[model samples]
Target: MLDTQGRNEPDTLNSDTPEQDLPALDIPKHERRVQTVIQDLPVETLCGRISRGALILQPEFQRNFVWNSTKASRLIESLLLNIPIPVVYVAEAAGGKQDVVDGQQRLTSISAFVAGTFPGPSGQKRDFKLSGLQVLNELNGKRFSDLDSATQNLILEATLRVIVIKAESHPDVKFEVFERLNLGAEKLNDQELRNCVYRGRYNTLLAQISQYKPFLDIQGLSAPHNRMADRQLILRFFALQRLTHLHYRGNMKQVMNRELEDHRDPSDAALKHLEELFTRSIDMAWAVFGPRAFRRYQPGTATQPDGMWEERLNFALWDTLLYTFSFYQKSDIIPNADRIYEEFLDVMTYDATFAEYVTSTGDKADRVRYRADTWRRRMDAVVGPPRSDSRTFSRKLKKALFEADSSCAICSQQIQTLDDAEVDHIVHYWRGGQTIPENARLTHRYCNRARGGRED
Candidate 1:
């Protein structure tokens, strides 16, 4: 039986072995306090464990195997030519269990290469053929091969060394451990981390919404921009059941994961409310058009004389925004959902697409292009500026320095303004500091000249 308090205590469940007794378990109750040990493990055994699902990728765990074709092929070369791989890190779990805490990418890459699958940034590339230590590839259908044999043998002998830790049994414990261990490494964002933790009903819902054609097709949404949006969408659609303005930060993932972990199954009441809202939103999107297809909204100022495409697409955009708002609500439908929905509809109908002109394909096409371009430009406009308001440069600079924790690159002292500081070039203007963000750094007025006005 599971503990009502959800504690992994001895009284919670029955165990056939005394070794399985909760008290006998020497691991720490909280994962954050746990220490890791490095161990050498065989690649074959690791793959076997992963395939059997005995190895659980804690919900907050990240799957970042950044190896491209060349790197992947080298892994195969080492293996085939009989080289040693490095040590692998495995986190010790309860009941004498262990999991790959690090080296997931290396292990995964080795598996992929052996299985004859190599993935790139876009998709799988079948063109990779391992020749000694080098990877031969036909780019644009032209052939290029990897480095030579002694290198191949050297690669193969690479040892697999891993830093292993004991994973805490509970989700909360695991989350805390994940947070601490992932620092300075490529850490998963809150949502992604949340997704890692609660790989249950809520996670499925999130994945569904992420890939949902209507939602995913919306513009200005991509992996980086959508991280927060994705979590917000799931929360609003299922948890809140209504549209909510997104604050975009906070421990949203942790809060939501706790809620889901508590609820073993989807609540009927919540699901019914969500389904109704979903149907209503979708129906309303097309209701303005007619019994047939929906029309695009176009303002009077639009270049097109008359068309419906603009309104249709705007409806789609609004729908996308509304979906995000709904998900942002996080598990309970909000009272303001209807108001938000209506307000967005109004924006789509009037501000975005006025009825003065009919929005056809060409008109809708142009509006979509304009909106995409405009939104990007608007976002970029203030991105470099520190303050949200752009008219005041000094205010913007101050905000950037303070909010971003920016400091003089050379002195490593924080800078607040032009009065005491100035921008210095890493490469002299004669050598090309070029006045770009990368080459420029905040410096004291005297330091700027002393260091040749360079960041370095």
Candidate 2:
């Protein structure tokens, strides 16, 4: 039977093969150093550590505190009744600090009660009061302070079982533990788990770029507050960029995890380049398609306009467009923006073959490559083919325009500003010219127009 997350639960093993007939399952000794210790600590001790910041209840990896006062009260009631609670998983960081990987809601509720505050409807901190207690009806609507000393001591002295994954354990092992433990109850989304597993420069960069205004505007998101969905989209762009050739053979989650692991500690220069690349691509998309950047466009209907676009964001379209813009030059992209936008709409409307790539489950590596390649080819038909050395030309153009203040090659006049300049092929495209920096020059738009597709 499928679980809540749609994953199938394992069936009972009814194998007839003897143990000697089974194949050996081997794991490298060096990779098996996962050390975990179980301890039962008093609730007062855990709360004191949280208050002192020694126990990190809320790490960047954890979701926001979402437990309501009623739920908190239920947990408190359970504790007071001496019921067996689930063991919480914690990872030991350096210098004796502990990060609570699982059981955040339970721990946070405990901490909040100890601190005498609970978040109200408006998210303001208010006095913590237990309510909606069915078994413990007498204790309903009572705050911790209102409890008798014996009852308070019962809560404070309650021991919670914690599974501590030691600092010396492999990081991947810890991530696996976190993932397996939380897969059923209070499960984290894939990106949330990724944020915890891949905590480094690249992860930080993805979080930063996901909040860029153009990205937020295109996704119709006001803020990066939706379960890290925007951040996940940003991560998809980078991951698919790396796996564009469809080399990966696993699921989408595996692809994302591998990509994050590969880029966990990217250099500052690389991070800055990625930031610029994503920002420029997003800006270009905004300039071309406006609010309909990633939305699917339906052709005119009897009741709808000539181009009826869906308000909901389409991830398939987003990934295809992001891959296209991310891998192509902005100068090349800007010239055919209108055509690209129109053709994308037409492709979505008329091309049934392309539709399957996006409409169905497109997480397969081949599907990803197919959709990206199909859209890329369509865009190329409008923008001209991307050169193998296009990145070199892009860097050169930036240096020429921004660093050197280069002038127009056609008119031999100073190109005063970026808005006034355009990077052009010194040898026109129709005349067998390559789109390389050596064959390119910064020219005023009017000057470039003055050339008028001339071979010379």
Candidate 3:
């Protein structure tokens, strides 16, 4: 009902109020409706778009696909059996690219089945045979190619509804609308949203590396994190490596988001190198610290490492400890476990710098830098000073050293190439040796780590 000024009255909810017609909601005319275009595109056309990269079948972030071949095959059978399936929701981005926001499983499975390769138990894509069809029992065990010509046409020509949320519907708005529509569904996190914002191989690497076994074993998990927590941790590792040298400043979340945006599409080699770095560093961390890898240590019990670590994981300590580990190779760190673990425990158990910064204001730039610095300094005191881009010998000095004797000082073997040669401190850095050329000797990267700070 309109009031005296023509303003609509709020609807009354009094239990005693008599039933009456209520005015419809008066939404502002300028408010934009979700501009969407619907198409009943044939399965073949949809698959073609996916293959051509015009339509993205996978969401930008890696989804833990719950559909096994059995589930995927059922989707195919439904298509062939003429059973109606749900519509695929695509968000049309600028440049005419369409990203799948919903129905990823159905579309991805159909495309994979048609292509003859589907994700197997090990994550490798392999050719699959159809199975578990209730009605088409005779069609079970048949590959896509095994189907007769008429059946193949039936599969390809089947129409699937495609709902395109026009590019004008911003990504943020799309997410909010989707969540509002899917009320009671799980909420999305930053990393999950990044998977949509940043579409490329780097995002895939985040998903893949988050499942590294040693890290999971340390965390006491049998599977990858269903939430993107592990992925964020992995991302922080890479982002810090990039930002640390620049003396990073900003909110951690913004830093991570910018990093993802900057390197959305990294080269395969770059991804592989990062994989090795994480694998090697995490393996050494697991070897040295065991289950107590990243938790606060203080208890006196046998259930945890050093009889003192709590069950909770510490994010600050995780990056700080792993940064120290990254300075040395896993091969050398394994043998030095006794010293490294003892030092790490001393820091975790007693050092104020390590304890204070990590427990509170942990994400502060100063705290982050000092926590890592404190661990690195302690580690260097035991293992010796490491090669530094800023503190190391000049290129001229390095050349003179190699020319004087092109042999590894530690291994006492001929150095094959300049790329494989690294200058070592004759008197360990912690033992008061200067980074001067007189104290430096060229050695292979492998030999230097294996030497483990011992005097020649």
Candidate 4:
């Protein structure tokens, strides 16, 4: 999801996914719920709802309140002057709670001003004083508290016509309406919509995993902000894994929806297992490639030996590497970290199959398949076929292999001592070689590492 310049900065909450995965414009009328109601709420009553939790301002639905003192003062000026403000829109959530769909900045500005705390100097909240009034210069330097009783009553009783879309509305319908109505800078992307629509244990897991240090370090993003872009990426990883067996809908949103529905309320045991895999894969990814993880590269020349590293995060590459790494624990991948990294670079550089078409048609299942399968086969070659076998053979097997053969099976060299000797798999552990004594041999640890495993 990086640009050509390789500057995939996560400073904003907006996702860089090229596709818009929201529902279609023409949904069936029978499935739609677009009822709405209007309430003329006074400023004081509305602010009290915010205080008592009857109203909610979800960050995922909009951007942070960024109005300055001058702008806020203008709003207060309008209230004092009785100028009709713009209509506010809200969605009726469960428990009769209203979520602000639009007008967050205006609402927050009113709330902040009435509370005597406006966004002031040095990013700190301080008592708001009326300033920068073009026509109301006479009212300058007056806080809300400084107002006379009649003026205070006017400010508190200022009417705001709020249109609340009822809770019966479908999520996609709500999302569709909000897309048009929302005038905020941070529009709800797919994941943000999912975060709003699917509030459950699995969604909570996505938020949790996105903050993981290795995951954040690799992504170069600090946390899940207003848009929940990182949360989307986290969802992609787990969702795609589930889709490995399920039918593939080419549409990404449908794919994500299925995944969320499948595990909306996962058991503690299930969450624990998935979490282990996520953390382990992330740890292995960071350990193996470091900053180069999920980045692209150009093939190297004979002189260069290793090609140039392109600092970009390709989502397709991210899917392949992270998903493949998830199958094994960190202990499985850590031993051959250097080898894995170098060989992976070579694959990206020399092999066109793995490197090509990562952007244009990358989301296709076949494209994901060959790339992941290639890397996985390479892993099997390097770290051995995943037979749940431990690297450490028992002491009895080590001694028996040593006693059975005084010479190393790999190099046919004489064993010096057991301290320097290591149990090497004869058939190569990577090639489905088991840990049985028949397949065991003694060799110098140096020889084993440098050049040991063989095929018969």
Candidate 5:
């Protein structure tokens, strides 16, 4: 977890200790270097600035324009009614350009209305029409161009209060201001925040990698998505890989943020290396696991039908397996592809403790360690150990057999000895029974045969 020094330390999972023991954040006070100027500019002036590229309505940090025409209309109605709106914040950029840090939705709405068009998804722009107005009922259903000269003049003359952060401010100070202003507003996920705070070649590379067809297919996602979930997963993979390479042990969130901040401005060679690594790793995963690459697989039993393998990607499994595979040479992987696939399933099915660690422990540091360490060990064993680890009975099945005194489950008769007793699937395999221990029962060889291969 993150420590007082902003570094990660290996975490111990103690059930007795509460997980709420978070390290205190140490924020130092610094001299004020950021200067801000507040001014009320006429809507016409703002629109002119936007048209001239002096105002940046969409920054890398801003989410998509989500307001429907009705919501946009409501803002216009409020403006017409002389109701006060919240102040918009902007960061001053070079060449007299201003990046909209907050109030993007409001500014975009105004800009679209003034331009006589609303921005649509995928770069399609549509005509803007006012609707759902309360006080300005007469103005409802009218386009900006349809308004009379006096009405247009009133709107153009309306002023909006804006606060602009000077260009001379430190980037960190600007990030701090942006974070504080939007903390309670429409919340941007951590990845979205990172994209804004760390905008450079490395961040651009992440976006490009996220759109790669193989990467999207493995993730079960499509390109040009808005929610940023896919980007976050990509970031997660890169962050964990970096941590593992550096042998760093800390909080996942802190590690991700720090890594992005450090690598914001990567060299061309570094970006190319990362791109190749990500592409090759994803391709290998798809080739080996097929569509079920990062899904959870549960061994089925009699009480429950074998839980079919899931199609959804499991983040825990993805991080561990991806990082492990990225370490191997192509020569090592291509020849042993089948062996690696079989070993992965065997590890997932036989290693109960590792499965539990991945499924149960949320994103705790210890859980991350458990998964990575277990996968590493399993990968190493693939080329060395015997293909199968012996057909071992599960603990549950063994306990049941011992309690039954070697009684045949089919006939309920006692068997002579362990050698004569065979473990049978209560629900036959052909009938969709899972090969889990819970589905197994002790039975004599003859009784098992007499029962045939019929479903129970």
Candidate 6:
């Protein structure tokens, strides 16, 4: 437990902390600044520090774990060889205590190895056979005791280089230090804290819905975290209903709490509402673009940079929703708004074929298409005046053709006629035809040219 300075404040450093009393230590020439391997630090002690209210994983921060156990073991072997290891960072706890910032995995492994907790390969034990001159004893063969004294001495000597950072007064200040130190580094994300807020509330609701007979097969939920971020966005997209500028700082729990408190009681209505929405929207995605195209669009491949899968998926779903809303605006038999939202999620998540299709179109083009379509809609609403320029009319005409379902609006022919299709005004320009949807259609280039339809 953190020893509190006052009843209300937990472990806040006041004026008398050691950081204030001790003069700053200079870096030694031999031990300038390097990570050091420290042995004999008990596993119990380490785990205790981690559990004691330390912000183990900062929100939006993920610990680096690319280095596998082999590298870790090699680090251990280097320590055993009495060679200088790298410098390890240890932050000062509130009352002159310390916590590891970097090298946590190596530290944890050593602790686990000390406690005989590491699963050795091929039924081997957590012991090593060493060959060298005896100092503390030879550290050899399966278990701590098997190591002779010299090896133990080498491990102990390595611990001497550990540089401890004595935290200054105002212990909460450490959080600022932590943030600054990691500002450029990869950080944890908001969705990671779903349980912290909604332990028995919204998250529970989502979990229950997921386990229910119909929802158990949500493959998106089972994907890797990047893909799952896409899943999370799907959930948040519907839950929030506006994606003009979604951010990582928005807490899902707070939103869920607000939504739940508005309800009458603990019921399956909300859960089922979300599931049904995903199912319907996914159906629409399949219907509109074809499932094969959707899969190619799933943005979670290894080739892309880290942490982009979810954002791209979010963008795609938002655009698709815009498309659906626009398409169904004139129809009375439109599916339930809530149901369509959920189906959109399913199309993004479980429908691998749909994911591929979207990926195949490529991310850059999809984004461009979304932006262009949005601009086209805006222009359509604006050009309702008595008159406009030919340039304005021409741009709007091109956009309509681009957004239309078929290349040739009249005969449902493929629009890829390579400069052979011309935008025809439903109302002739000379006949005072306005630049609008009703006045737009696709015609063969030759037909349009022969008709002398160039001027507005």
**Model 5: runs farther than 4 Å from truth?**
1-40, 91-98, 126-132, 140-153, 163-187, 222-224, 300-308, 383-456
Model 3 per-residue lDDT at 102: 72
For each candidate, the alpha-carbon lDDT, in order, equals: 0.43, 0.72, 0.70, 0.72, 0.71, 0.40
RMSD, each candidate, Å?
26.8, 9.3, 13.1, 9.1, 17.9, 21.8
Poorest 10 consecutive residues of model 1 by lDDT? 11-20
Cα displacement (Å) at residue 154, model 4: 2.9
> Per-residue lDDT of 368-389 in model 4, one digit per residue for the tens?
6777788888888888765476
Better of 1 and 6 by lDDT: 1
Q: In each prediction, how many residue pairs overlap at the backbone (N, C-alpha, C within less than 3 A)?
A: 65, 0, 3, 1, 2, 56
* lDDT, candidate 4, at 80: 83
Best by TM-score: 4
Inter-residue clash pairs, candidate 5: 8-249, 8-250
Using TM-score as the yardstick, the better of models 2 and 6 is 2
What are the per-residue Cα lDDT tens digits for candidate 1 across 266-301? 666855565445544433333322222222343343
Q: What 10-residue stretch in candidate 6 is worst by lDDT?
A: 8-17
Residue ranges of candidate 4 with Cα displaced over 4 Å:
1-16, 19-29, 32-35, 58-62, 119-124, 182-207, 220-228, 257-274, 301-306, 349-353, 384-456
Please give the range of 10 consecutive residues that has the lowest summed lDDT in model 2. 8-17
lDDT of 6 by residue, 126-238 (tens): 44333232442333233544556765455544552344544432222323233344445443233322222222234444444434321222222232233123323344444
lDDT of 5 by residue, 1-456 (tens): 112221212221111112463322223356345679999998999999999989988866567898999999889887888888899988776567888878889989988998999898878998899988888889888989999998888788889999988876655555557667766776554556656656567777877787888777775555634545566667777888877834645445556666776787788899888888888788768777877788878877689866568655676787788888777644345556788888877777889988886566346667678778777777787644322322335656665685767777778878876667777766655334456777788888788778775421
| Model 4 TM-score, all chains together | 0.71
Q: Model 3 compared with the native: what TM-score?
A: 0.57
**Model 2, span 1-456: residue lDDT tens:** 112222322210111122343332223569666788999999999999998989998766667788889999999999999998788888886468888888888999987887889965445899899988999989887888999999999999999999988877755555567667765775665667777766667877877787898777776666664456667777777777777745645355556667787788799898988888788778778877988887766667678657766776666777788778887655666667788878888898778867776665435556667777788788878877764543224654655664575677777778777777777776665334567767877878788777786422
